[model samples]
Target: MTEHQALRIRRFSTDSAPVGERFDAWAAHSTYCDMVTTYRSDLPFDAHRDNVSIGPLILAGRTWRHPDPSLAYDAKRTPARIRADQRDFHSFSLQICGTAALRSDASTAVKRAGDLYLLDFARPFERVITPGSEISLSVPRDWLPADTGKLHGASLTRGVGSLFGDYLMSLYNTLPQLTRHDVPHIVRATTELLKASLHPELDTLAAAQTPIRDLLLQRIRRYIDDHLLQPDLTPGSICRDVGLSRAMLYRLFESAGGVMREIRQKRLYRVHQVLSSPDRPEERIRDVAWRHGFTDEKYFYRIFKAEFGHTPRETVEQVRHRRETGTN
Candidate 1:
């Protein structure tokens, strides 16, 4: 990875502190130290956290070790604390080793190993955390859909939930090798997985299963863009090449106003780009349209006008004028 894409990892541990002062040091280093009150057991407190910031999301791998397994720590976010802090964010924690009981006004559940649960920081909540390791993801409230409020304190361990939990673990494991170019795609996939796993009623879930559906959609779009200049780039060809059934292809692009419509729009965009380029001044608009798989000149002109609010000739003229005047 380039220097700019290099992963920035921050490690916080109580290992350097004296045994008597370890718990306080751990609390001081916590990300939510001010938002919650932490109570530790009498046993020696030992904790370690590694954090990586990926765009707007923060992914952390945390471990708490104590001599007593029954009670590691109790952290509570009270109403007064919430009001005083005014923090609004969502936390998705995947328990990797042990169990924890989470409670909030929206829901209450115990999350065991391999289980994932969500916490909304805007709401008051309590967590009786046992000695364990977990992968935690912190997402800004605005980054999630409004309906995600229902997921607060909800334990997810089945079906799509399991898939999401596994994805998080995999992402955490591979974070060290990822580049900056991968950040946007990771964020998009994470959002899609979260939406699919947390909200089943969403229309986007009808296309396919989470992560698989997300990957397929990306592949389809890339394939379409790569072959936009081909004349026989129809849904049948896409289905054949992308290994998707015709029904599944249609379902995948349903939210995009159907596959054929997407093709037409993409062609129109290509034609518009050609028309608006000063270097392509000698190329006729019809030839540009045909090159982009728009065979019917009249139909192309109509749709082009409808899409851009101007005729193809107008776009060329505007480009010519801007080139001559040396102005954008």
Candidate 2:
């Protein structure tokens, strides 16, 4: 496929249209136009949108420049409209330079600049947008973690929300430069980041347990064991190879502190076993530790003592004494 076919891009602007037809033209191009009743302002309407489709995700940058402060537009998605359209996706809008208000059956929120708000297209909602600019991302509902319904119509202004907003902005800025080969990785990373931002808690295994989760966990553990000696082994690599989302992978290992912690402990255990063995008697302790992915001698000693309650040298000495004394 061609580059354009790989990453579809669409641009809509009111600047090229007559002032009288701007609102109609802009609304006609909107993804929500079919499912929403848009109320146009009597004043002149001005808006622009650039949309890029990367895999299953749609990222759009929008800006509205009204000549008067009172010039605003609003849209309402009623139950009838929702039933008619049957759109089931989540839209995360990060306000960059304007303010907006959303009201839904669940809650009401006022989103200011630097705030991010979520909208579920399947739900009944109404939103009023003033003169402002924003980046909006539409993702499949199933891409998000469970229990994200609580985020509907809610605005996130700080913490992980802020970081997610920054990420959305950066992604928007670079969308034009992204290629088809980059789509899958981008989609996975974006989905994982969105899951982490929206749901920061470590979900209990009991809550997320399933046959697939169990199978994935087993596969991940096996992969880690097989690659334990590889110094470059990381969560990212594991996720890519094991076909698991970062959020789900972390949740699977939450009880063990985390995947990285598990990897570290497993590596340390292998090092301990090697150090305690009578074979390869000429191998230096540092070499044994380094072979198992630990490069810093001091850190190796520290963690080795912390894990096994004794220094590496002490363990080696005990093994030597056992060999000399013919002890088991």
Candidate 3:
């Protein structure tokens, strides 16, 4: 692909179109959709942009330096709109250059350079950035392994003097070095770091498993793992078991491709572990698959290969060959 085709960058400015139409277009298509921006009529307006998309994630470093202060509202993400959009993502505004005043239903603060704040598109909120530029990362919410609700309207200014602030800045600076193949792994690590920065006490697995009523994501993850072997592990089952509403459950696992996808992933991971273990020398591949609640041999083979890039029999043969040769 040509450089232009490889990068999906859309630019909007008052010089190209009428001011009202220009701002409206930028708000709709700039980063996340379902947003509306308003500016004062008396002041001059000038907005420029550069955005890069790595797989499902969007990194946009835009110029918020205009004469008039503006408010960007995420009002169109109602339940019906969310269903219509069919996209589960969140944006983190990292103040790369200057500060911006943020106002959400939960809190309000000045998000300065090195500060990172959650931008929830599913809920209604507005932000007023001063004359400066900021880079925002639009990430899949499920990719983040934390109760996103807890992060709504929250800010980690300079990550409380941690390297997380610098880490995010480095991510933005090094976007060109990442390829589509590397996006998923990069996103996962970034999410884990972001979660850790939010809750430092989340350093240990034991501390991570707080009550689900508190909307602790690790506990919900643990619950999912404990019940992954059950044949009836549906979204409804998870919601009922965890005492979370359907919407909340959906939100919790949105970036994970929803709860059903998560269950399949866990099952596939377990199957891979069994296939690779010497402790399972007596177990046949089919028996291991069945033990992991995979009843259809054909479907299991298909998804297993897709998930691991190798067949179950191939994995088992490799394990046996390695064991016999004393090679790991």
Candidate 4:
């Protein structure tokens, strides 16, 4: 194995400082690890036996014994933030000893023993862990596939009573019993289960062109429209952010007729949205289309008819007429 990435670990066993002091203490460690930058201290817990870990592929190492004051952190006024020391790695933290109240990048979630919290390292975020809980975390960036468009910002979990969730719990519960010789196999299994938890549908329909194809196609199409005017908008830029390669990226949209078609479809959808705006009755159809990546009125009209079976002006006229005639 490569050198163990220092998943920064801090244990405040006997510290009796206020929450601000705790914030500074954790912030000091952030400098040592490059993956995280901003640190926000939530919840006022002055004293409690707490241990927090941050790193890639494996962020957890210690278990908190019965050395407690009251264990927990909740960012009331402040939220947790971190920068990825490494670009590709992501994290999945599982509680083995007890349950924890976790608030990660997007939401406030609770994870009990056998349940894992997936944290996006690339984004700035914070997590609040309740005291007296033992955790086993897995970070396996190296295991992720090259084409990850379908996986970017995908929801981070499969709940219990599922195969992946069961595997995660089984792996964590049995890791202590496995010897060093067995680490590789256990780690491999853990990684597989983690991916499965996050991408069950992708696994099933990867070979055949399916709705998984359109889901990603539609999502990417929407993403392009939202950032249509950005100068940096391009296939290369989209691939980088979503973690997909060019070929696999094409495959994801194969069922949707290809990337360009999806983009055109999305642009038409945006055109329709603006033209049907009843609140802006004074706005002309040409100006509305131009405002949303449609610069040429003639070209926009042709494409609008080709895609929606109605000319841009006709659609707007229908909408306006309906509203005026009480037929809408």
Query: Pick by TM-score: which candidate is best?
Result: 1
Count of backbone clashes for each model? 0, 0, 2, 12
Candidate 2 structure lDDT: 0.77
Instruction: Give the TM-score (vs. native) of candidate 4.
Output: 0.39
Per-residue CA lDDT of model 3 for 60-128, tens digit only, reads 777755544444323234455556666667777778765666666756777776677787777655565
> Candidates 1 and 2: which is better by lDDT?
1
- List clashing residue pairs in candidate 1: none
Span of 10 residues, lowest total lDDT, candidate 4 = 75-84
Q: Which candidate is the best by lDDT?
A: 1
Which residue segments of model 4 deviate by more than 4 Å? Answer: 1-222, 225-232
Question: Any runs in candidate 3 off by more than 4 Å, and if so which?
Answer: 1-15, 18-21, 28-44, 67-86, 158-162, 201-328
For 199-287, candidate 4 gives per-residue lDDT tens digits of 55566324223332433344455457667656466678766554446776787768778776766676678778777776566776777
lDDT of each: 0.79, 0.77, 0.65, 0.51
The estimated TM-scores of all candidates read 0.59, 0.57, 0.48, 0.39
What digit string (tens of lDDT, one per residue) describes model 1 on residues 207-276? 3255556656766777789798998899987876666568878898899899899888987888788788
At residue 94, what lDDT does model 2 achieve?
91
Candidate ordering by lDDT (highest first): 1, 2, 3, 4
Error of 2 at 292 (Å): 40
